[model samples]
Target: MQSNGPLYLLHQGQVVKFGFRVERRHVNPMDNLHGGMMASFCDMLLPLSVYRKDSAVGPRFLPTISLQIDYLAPAPLGCWVEGEAELLRATRSLVFAQGLVRADGVLCARVSGVFKIGPEFTPETAKP
Candidate 1:
């Protein structure tokens, strides 16, 4: 589950909503979500934002140069964490996005990220 690869390939869509049933394995010793898990969600958000509109371009598994997140509340085991990302801006070499994560219908995390578009990256090469 820690893998960077999308959990489900069909994960890229306009209304790309994703939810995962949190388990004990997803928890920290404190019975709350481990920070890394939430962090990973931030990582997933950007690539999805690009693919959601067009699956073959915009995102090339680019490395995030900067990622900042805020924990609004605790996320516990057995709760499904779900969220969406919206593209704030897009340029030839960068994309900015924001995302939210809700646990039990409460916003548990909010995030902002920037993706550095890499070489050979262009929307023209996109394929359905």
Candidate 2:
């Protein structure tokens, strides 16, 4: 998935917004955005919703525990995709999140995930 990125991010209070442009690499044979690409994008977006720089968790490295994605429609090639993610809940050791993926304002997919709260995040830990 690393090769599929250069994803753009925006912060809106408790919601994290991600913007992606569908490129040649992101599309399937039918010229629609690939399901795998959408899944990976949601996976990256969900954990970000739990980040709180001022809290004890404080931008921790979150390891995904479970992820579920529902494909609702196809995002055709060359379209812009936006993913809005928000935290559903957070416990002592886990965080749950949900997100909606839209292409040019039309719903394309729904996502939910559970992640394990891990060590504090650092640039070094983000490397593949």
Candidate 3:
């Protein structure tokens, strides 16, 4: 499991949807969803989005080079958080993506990321 989250794959073909429930551990001191957790969720969302589209060939192993998250609102605990991502661009060695995180129908965060899509991620070249 690449993610520590209880994330689930919703629609895996064209548009990728990943969702999870906000638990107590995901909150901050004020009982709002932690920014770090939200950023982590976005990190997972982007790569999964890229891989879902390229599934016919194989799983795409993308490592984040840069990730940016914009916090728009707070997500209370016990809310259902859904992440949807779009592949903005793909080059020979990089992939760019952006998405949104919505909790209980309210937009809570927006995220964009750049990922490296090269040999380092492949099983043959990865170090164990």
On TM-score, the leading prediction is 2
**Which residue ranges in model 1 land beyond 4 Å of their true spot?**
1-13, 54-59, 119-128
When summed lDDT is taken over every stretch of 10 residues in candidate 2, the lowest stretch is 49-58
Q: What is the per-residue lDDT of model 3 for residues 36-108, given as tens digits with 9 covering 90 to 100? A: 9988889999888777876432365688999999999999999988989888888888888899999998999
How many residue pairs clash in model 1?
0
Candidate 2: stretches off by over 4 Å: 52-56, 123-128
The TM-score measured for candidate 3 stands at: 0.86
Question: Over the stretch 16-125, how does candidate 2's per-residue lDDT look in tens digits?
Answer: 68878999999999999999999889888787655732255557988899999999999999999998877777889988888899998899999999999999877887
lDDT per model vs. reference: 0.72, 0.84, 0.83
TM-score-based ranking, best first? 2, 3, 1
Candidate 2's error at 65, in angstroms?
Answer: 0.7
lDDT of 1 by residue, 1-128 (tens): 34432343335336776566667767899888888888887678656666576544454655687788999998898887787777777777777888888888999999898887665545775443
Pull out the clashing pairs in model 3.
none
